[model samples]
Target: MNTLYRLGQFSIALTFPALAILLAVFGLPAVLLFLSSLNAPDFSLTNYEAFFSRGANVRVLLQTVEVSVIATLMCVIVGYPTAYIFAAASKGLRMALLVLVVIPYLTSFLVRTYAWIVILGDGGLINTLLLELGLISSPIPLIYNRMAVYIGMVHIMLPIMVLPLVSVMVGIDKSLSAAARSMGARPFAAFCRVFFPLSLPGVLSGSLLVFVLCLGFYITPAALGGLGDAMLSTFIAAQVESSFDLARIAASSFVLLGLAAVVLGIFGLDLSGAQDSRPHPAWKSPPDWLRSFGAPTRRVKELAARHRAKRWASTLYQAAGRGHLWKVVGTAFVALVMFYLLFPSVVVIIMSFSAGPSLHFPPRALSLQWYRSFFNNPSWTDAAWISIQIGLAVAVLSTIVGTLAAYGLSRTFPRLRSTLTMTILTPITIPSIVVGIAAYLGLLKVGLIGTKTGIILTHSIGATAYVVVIVSATLANFDRRLELAAKSMRASPLRAFTRVTLPLVRPGIIAGALFAFLHSFDEVVQTSLVSGFSVRTLPLKMWENIRHEIDPTIAAVASMLVLLPVAWLIVFYFTLWRSRPTVSGVPLETAS
Candidate 1:
């Protein structure tokens, strides 16, 4: 009876908060999506039918898949070599390489996509340099094309591919190649026969991740692709913002969601098999025959082996010894990517300071004319303010709800755990434009459309899944026994959570919050649908400006955005470093 009472108390403590978060952020929003798709004067499949009937929608869906597949393929091709190099390199070199990869990820995706515009556009750096070098008399048609979209998307998504590949690669036995060589296999042949097959899981997993992410991409394609190069996300946005057809948008979203699920399911199955099939390589001694040669033959063999080992070791040592040089080179590479990512935004910033009425890069002279103009314009300022407010609200709410969901789902449970995980991650799989349209249609009856609250709620919903994933990762590595100990000391669950669990996981929670804030701050499609004339966000304002002016002030805004997050990351890293012991602490228990 006493044990039952304790169990009841635990259930009460855990269930309500988890349920509240799940229903509000995950369950309710999904239910609303279904209702919105079905709600009409009469129940019908007309939305789905209209979706198929529209040739443009079909084209957009196909284009989205094409871009995603191409980008993911490019990521794998590029990322595999990069990850292999990192895994084989010495520790210092690996860390430096990792830092280089992470820089692009830390920066804004919009900014990076914008940077490609500056590089690929007519009269831009790439064209100007090529022309100066007499490579071509005319600028190439690079920007506003399918190729540009692929390049931009790949640049932003490459780190995602590389990180996962690196994780898997680190687990590979370094002596597998040596073992194969001892069996008389050549170096290249050994790699082909052994190493490549072992790394297939990482390749598939990374490719799937990049592809799914690319499916929902809007900023890169919208900024880089031509009219005919539109992807599903861009098309859906156009539907909501221009056509305002809620039903068609919902149907298109459903198609995107269904396709993403199929792709992910296939990849998930493959990953499961791959995980189970991993072979543990065992080391073996050199053959006795080889060890028992005549003194002269043994001496020759010894000399040859030493020579070969020295040659291989020298090659690797030389590469590793140049770690400092590689750091500099990696830093330069990262800086170049950053410059490319930030160039358009930097141009916009420069233009914002233009003395003239029109937008210009390398402003004739510097003035805060656009800045004054922007502030003076009520529409732009109002939108900017609304976006800031919505972003902050969404960031806080999503972080809190997502952290709780992460905690609940991270606990041991039945098969329902995987189902719940899928539910939490579903928002990311669904196209944002679809989410936007669904929210618009569903909320119309609830009077959420054309309201600031509606926009905040929508952004929060979209940001929650990302937060959950990030926070869940942090929780996965956390020590739960600390909480148990606190509970044993007579601390209530809330107190134990507040005093123990919160501090330990604060870094991840903050990281999740920062990501959520940036996501909401940069969101365009969903915000466009829910936001009325009265509630305009910064990205919406930027979208409007890009459509009309093609000015440098946008660049300026983007540069500022890039700097703020980079600055936050710096502080975050410092805080993380300071919190850790200089000496290695005791390791936590791992799952069996």
Candidate 2:
């Protein structure tokens, strides 16, 4: 009773456990890493100088920037029109299209990357089809090239760009464009002058999200690209494998971090599309000159309107005729975009059941041999089991800690909440390899490395940030009076919270737990660094198999991985979607 009372008195204390874990695991280590890069106590620029002095290092840095810029541009080019169509869609159609976009976004990053490998490999789908059609003599080097790198990257990043754009575009006033049209602007002119400017924030948000994420490109570039296609993250990972040179590694990690920070600073980061949702003024007064000239002209135009009706009616008819054609073109374009996003997964799922020892898109025979191989094999089963245990632990821990932190932040001043929320999000907002290196050093200090405890802790920091975001969004809409009413009825603070507040916020909590589990389950970049090569989670195991051997068993594994997102989507629909009020709690659905 006393403890509950004391806890209720200081709501901010609720954030401590999460903050403590973050500080120990990520924050402190990041500071230490910065110091390590500077050779702290001695404090020299030698390490950084050494890094830039190398021609290969400099080239990789430049290449990372180039690739990220090109990929971001590609996403913008493809995503803008798709988003426009999506926003203009009817409610039911928009909802369905959103689900389609999210399925790939929520799918395992590793699985998606692997699907591209299966499709683009010499023996994979495209090449094989070409050979059968007698269109090509050889595979044409599809898999391991710069072009494949762009294809895989753009596929993975398209949803990130589209989702934000659609969110902003949907909230825009359709009447604004109609108003422009009434002012005698053509449809394209109206869109360019009114709609496009308003959607820039979404574009900025999506582009920042994609570009920063791409700056840290690791798994896809390494898996799909040739040796010359290495990003900074690839270089950093290779250095870690080759040597445990702390200063050099820290220098490289900070350099990558600095690159991300510079981009964020340059473009101005706003992961939350809050600006787009702000209510527009119902009407803005016309300019003095326009108002002065408009009254006489309006009456004159009204009198002349019947005279121009024949020409106007003819224009309307022709416009309506072209509208159907544009509609068909838009529908076809959207269909192609959906195909590009989803076809790879469909390919992998079909190939998973192959009776053959190696990958084949259209297998001569279909069997459950690969599935049986995955289950019966001890190595695969053990890794899966280990991953489950760790995921459960991370989910539970992150949910509790993050929910409390979010609740605390909700009670805080705006500036303090913003600062603390950003602090909590540090693990996830920066590159994974940077976070991984920090986690490794932190865990090393505490002797938790190479254990499930270390991996759980490593996964928890980022997972907790996800939880905070979801729960905070839910709390933003929560009615505080319910808890107060419960307390007024003589219920204790804990009782009021557990009985009233918790139930109201339960949906967000559940969604957060799901996201936390998924975050941990799909993690490989940080897991690999912190595992010290001793622990093997499912993703780690799958990554190993993908890199080392060419086995159809991996197809079975990848197929199962693909289903996880589909399952998550179904669960999300029931929880966040149906719940209505907290629909934004959908994981990564927003850049927020």
lDDT of 1: 0.70
Mark the regions of model 2 whose C-alpha exceeds 4 Å error after superposition. 272-319, 577-592
Q: Write the per-residue lDDT of candidate 2 for residues 1-592, one digit (tens) a residue.
A: 9897898688788889899999999989999999999999899999999999999999999999999999999999999999999999999999999999988988888889999988888888999999999999988799888989999999999999999899889978899898887756668878778888788878888999899889888999999999999999999999999988999999999999999998887876743212334544434889998789787688787777665555555575354667789999999999999999999999999998787667687878999999999999999999999999999999999999999999888887776777788778878778899999999999999999999999999999999999998899888877787667778889888877777677667888998999999999999999999998899889999998889865568889989988998898788778766654322232223212
Task: Show where candidate 1 strays beyond 4 Å.
Answer: 1-57, 130-138, 175-178, 181-184, 269-382, 581-592
Give the clashing residue pairs of candidate 2, or none. none
Candidate 1 RMSD to the real structure: 7.2
- Per-candidate TM equals 0.78, 0.90
